[model samples]
Target: MAKYKGRILFVLAGALLIIIWDFIYYFVLQYSFNLQVDLLFGTLILFIGYYTGKNYDESNETVSAISKSEEKIKRLNEELHLVLQNITEVVFHTNSKGEFQFLNHSWEELTGYSIKESIHKNALHFISLHERHEFLRVLRRSISEQKEKTKIDFSFQTRSGQFRWGEVNIKLNYDENGELAGTVGTISDITERIHNEEELLEMNETLAIESQKLSVAGQLAAGIAHEVRNPLTSINGFLQLLRDDADEKTREYLEIVFSEIKRIELVLSELLILAKPQSVTYKRINIVETLDHVAKLLNTNAILYNIEIQTAFKQRDLYIRGDENQLKQVFINLVKNAIEAMPHGGNIMIEAGLNEYNKVELSFKDEGIGMKKQILDKLGEPFFTTKTKGTGLGLTICLRILRDHSADISVQSEQGEGTTFSIKFEAAHQQERKKREQTQKVW
Candidate 1:
């Protein structure tokens, strides 16, 4: 048996003495206790009472500490909730199973869906289909490697079915015991930022195109002056000679002068069309008539190269709204290009019809040495040409005219196989022009 400690002994001795005093007073001592005995019992009882009170005080102290800790935790939780509610970007957490555990107020505001509707949903539900694979790959890699943080860009669909670009920063979560808990991520809407970046890129490209045009214009200016001066000088010298002396040679000289004047007039007209900005004059144009006129005009040029121009019209009366002269210019440039492509001489096929889209489809297919990818890519850039003596502005001017008419053009070429230039215009009978204007936000 173990020996009792001082406090235990005091308690036990006090209890035992009380029992003995009770027995002696009731049976042996017959109703009376001495004063000395009573004093001693009273002191023992006071010591035992003091020991009991001390134990209770120690228990109360421990309870008070625990209550204070609980109050601090409650305050911290309230502060976190307030912060999540007011933040502008999405804050979210998910379980290991990829189900959403919590979505902050920002999620509701950005996606236009209430928290009650999104709770416990799969996190992938908001990801766009095309971006889901990438999102999953990044997420799995982060979780598997226990990455502290990772970033990804993806498209997120809103409650109203609009997909917007988003960039998310993800962090893997763990419990206090270092076990896998889930993931927490923050998402920011990047749609407008991406759009602005694209706009800047397009603006830069346009600036580059304009700079090339200016350089080409400067070169053309000198060439035009030289080319025009020669023809004019020839006509002037011939007329002066005719005035000084009239003879049998005068008739031949007169013919030469007239031909020189015609050539100069043609050069000046082409230069004026390109250099001067003219207001668009809209009229209903017959596609067949325009094609015929262009073929007749380029017939002599084609015959010189031994290349034949073949025309086929599935619909004779196809109509579109555009400037007739500009349309004629477009075809002339295209046919001339076709003729130039085939140095060995080949057939140039021109076709016009209503395509499946109910738009007028006009195509120029050439059986010539096709263009390589590098040259084809820079087709519309000013001064970028593949020909040995080409001005390179023919295709650029065609593209500009097509855009002004709300038309579309495409080129398909394979090196050594041949090339095709396809142009599509809205049909006059259909309401396509109106629809195009509305979609393009044309004033």
Candidate 2:
């Protein structure tokens, strides 16, 4: 409305000026005024005024629109920055030379390096030395192939000197002339995922190997028991009959023969167990009590060997789902092994507690002659042992029993430093909760 009024006033002013000029030309100059010229000048002045006002209004509108557009752009930029700052993955930009040009807050969180300090640093600097070459090779290959985007997984060094897995996704950028400008990308922390995949793969391989071994052992055990048991039984019966009528020296020889036969019987029994494990009745059993019982049962044996058996529990009522007798047998075997490892006298530390994952963790640590890597790797194999008279089936049987109870075992040892066997089991409460969830799902 104001603009219209201004345009009207401009026209009126222009007409008034033109009329005053006409009067001055007619009266002051004493000349005849031409009506046609006056009318032409008035019309031209009106047209000029209207044209100027129309352009002024359009100019104002253009400026207002520009201001609004600038404000919107600024707001969008701020939102983009906020998203980049809070995301868990590191978003970054680099120059053609692979020098970092920009990095979001997540880079600092992942690498422990300040954004200010990390700028202009080479991307390869953070990668592990062994993996840097491969990283660069893949990046160059993608560029050479004229690929717009690429992904690579590599191990990168963190600020604390630890290497972690990172999956990098890169998008290439170019200048107006289509020449390479730089690259924008994201780095995701995939360390946990990678470790989990590796563990799963290792477990699958181990299960396959174990299955094959069990199959062979089963066939062997069946054949050996069928062919050897009857003859051994007949020979033992005749030997006992002959021993009752023999002299003192002959009786002593007969007793040794009886002991050898008994040892053979024990081996056969263990083989059978390995071939076909007995059916187990799993129940919620207190792990603390089981460990305590095993410790007490072996306490006298440890004492005679100049060894001390110690027990520690973080919680008194820690429980797990397992067969009680089988679990006790497993613990006994581990404790006995610990006692045997230390010939000169040492401490056998048995500890039970809840781990970070809320699983029941039980460990047997012994201060003794620890094994070399090659020997440790062979553990759990049938007929593998370090002891002079060991049949090597003890640990194999213990491993099978623990597997039946759904336990995970790990061994850590260093020559001259001693060994620790750690076992983890799902807590009884957790097991019950999982069952309930499955039941709910079924319903």
Best TM-score among the predictions, by candidate number: 2
Candidate 2, residues 19-82: lDDT per residue as tens digits? Answer: 7888888888888868898789889988887777677667777887899999999999999999
lDDT of each: 0.81, 0.90
Output the lDDT of residue 13, model 1: 65
Runs with alpha carbons beyond 4 Å of true place in candidate 1: 1-271, 431-443
Tens digits of per-residue lDDT, candidate 1, 174-273, equal 7776656888889998999999999999999997777677557746755786677677877678787775776768867777876766666555555545
**lDDT for residue 151 in candidate 1, whole number 0-100:** 97
lDDT of 1: 0.81
Q: Total backbone clashes of model 2? A: 0
**Candidate 2, superposed: residue stretches over 4 Å from native:** 1-51, 67-206, 244-256
TM-scores, in order shown? Answer: 0.46, 0.64
How many pairs collide in each candidate, listed in order?
A: 0, 0
